[model samples]
Target chain A: EAGVAQSPRYKIIEKRQSVAFWCNPISGHATLYWYQQILGQGPKLLIQFQNNGVVDDSQLPKDRFSAERLKGVDSTLKIQPAKLEDSAVYLCASSLGTGNGYTFGSGTRLTVV
Target chain B: AQSVTQPDIHITVSEGASLELRCNYSYGATPYLFWYVQSPGQGLQLLLKYFSGDTLVQGIKGFEAEFKRSQSSFNLRKPSVHWSDAAEYFCAVGEGGNTPLVFGKGTRLSVIA
Candidate 1:
């Protein structure tokens, strides 16, 4: 089966600029996740979606970051007024459920100057 | 709180030699452990996982990991290293059945011919 798909493999933006990333999960997968992986750091979970509803987003910066999975299929993550610290690779993954291993996309590498 | 730690930031090994990467986690309950590998400019891929059964779990590409509940560790091992094995490896922990994963910084493996 096809793996998760993401758009704009790379992005560069100035600090305080707005940016958005898109993710298309695998077919028949019930769980979708977005993670931020900074250089020399592990991928951090930004949000998780089970179907069209959010399961967890405690780590998300509500003031500037927002994510949504509409129709229980495709998802999008947006960061307004980006910061230098936001420079990292944003990865999208999908799983059948929490019990199964995840399949990930190539990711979108974002650089905020 | 749940957290993961990959003690080694990087490791170097010669091709055909054995390899091992360390991972430790802290959590309140019985944790679900996982190991993932990420190649340059690629997304994370599941290498192995440990939920409840055997401590030793085999993964794709000649990888395996042993979960030690006593030490709260899950270390990845490969009997013979290959040049293609050079990549970043991440360890993650999860609580509940399908909760968001908590990940460690990662260990970058360098293989020499």
Candidate 2:
């Protein structure tokens, strides 16, 4: 099966600039998630979508980070006025359902200068 | 809230040697556990998962993990380490369906020739 797909393998932006990352989940996956992995840290859940509706965004920095999974297929994560601390690898993952393991994309490495 | 702990920040072992990476999770109920591997500039790949039924789960690349409810631990193991296995390993715990996972800080493995 085709793996999850992500675009713009790398991105560099100045602080306070805006950037967006795109992801395409595996076919037939009903759940999608966005995670932020800072250097020397674990991946933190940014947002989660069950189909097109959001299931969780409790950890997302709503003031700066936002994500949407439209049509319950592809997802986009955007960071407005990106901060230096927001510089990290953004990973996208999908799964068929609960108890099923996830398939992750290569991720978008964003560098905020 | 649930959490995961990977106590080892880094570990080094010679090739063809036995390897073990420890993972501990905190959750209220029977937790879904998973181990993932991430190479440089790459996304995470599922090495194995333990949902139920079996305490010992086998994963890809000759990796295996044992889930111990009494210890609240799920540790990954490999009988013989290879250079290719040198990468970051992460342990994650999640609630089934529509819920996102909580990941550990991760353990970095280095294989010496």
Candidate 3:
């Protein structure tokens, strides 16, 4: 099976700039997730979508980070006015459903200068 | 709220030696557990998962994990460490449907000959 796909293996932008990352989940998967992994830290859940409808975004910084999984297939995560602290690897993952392990994409590495 | 903890930040072992990565999770209900491995500049790959039925679950690359309810732990084990096994390992917990997985900080394993 094809793995989850992500675009822009790496990105570099100045602080306060805007950046976007794209993700394509495995075929037929119903759940998509976005996570931010900082250096020396665990990956934190940024948002979750269950077939286009948001299931969770409480941890997302709504003022700066936004995510959408339109048509319940592909997802995009955007960080507007990106902070210096926003420099990290953004990972996308998908699963068949509950009780199954997730398949992760190669992630987008963002560097804010 | 759900959280995961990987007590070891890094570990080094001689090649062909046994290895163990500890993971502890906090959740109220019956929890779904997972172990993932990430090489540098790469995405996460599922090592194994525990939903139910068996306490010990085997995964790819000769990895296995044991889930202990009383310990609130799911520790990954490998009988013979190889140089390729040097990577970061993460432990995660998730609820069934809508909830996203909560990940640990990850343990970095270094293999020496």
Q: Give me the chain B TM-score of candidate 2.
A: 0.99
Candidate 3 TM-score versus the reference: 0.97
Over B11-103, each residue of candidate 2 has an lDDT whose tens digit, in order, gives 999999999999999999999999999999999999999889979999999999999999999999999999999999999998887688889
Give lDDT tens digits, candidate 3, residues B1-113: 88999999999999999999999999988899989999999999988888888899999999999999999999999999999999999999988765688899999999999
lDDT of each: 0.93, 0.94, 0.93
Candidate 3 per-residue C-alpha lDDT over A1-113 given as tens digits, one digit per residue, 9 for 90 to 100: 99999999999999999999999999999999999999988899899898999988999999999999899999999999999999999999998875787899999999999
What is residue B94's positional error in candidate 3, in angstroms? 1.0
Candidate 2 lDDT tens digits, A1-113: 89999988999999999999999999999999999999988899999898999988999999998888889999999999899999999999999875887899999999999
Q: Comparing chain B with the reference, what is the TM-score for each candidate? A: 0.97, 0.99, 0.98
* Runs in model 1 lying further than 4 Å from the true structure: none
Q: What TM-score, over all chains together, does every model reach? A: 0.96, 0.98, 0.97
Q: Candidate 1 versus the native: TM-score?
A: 0.96
Number of the candidate with higher lDDT, 1 or 2: 2
Candidate closer to the true structure by DockQ (higher is better), 1 or 2: 2
Q: Which interface RMSD does candidate 2 score? A: 0.9
Clashing pairs in 2: A98-B97
Model 1 accuracy (lDDT, Cα): 0.93
Candidate 1 chain A worst ten-residue window by lDDT:
A94-103
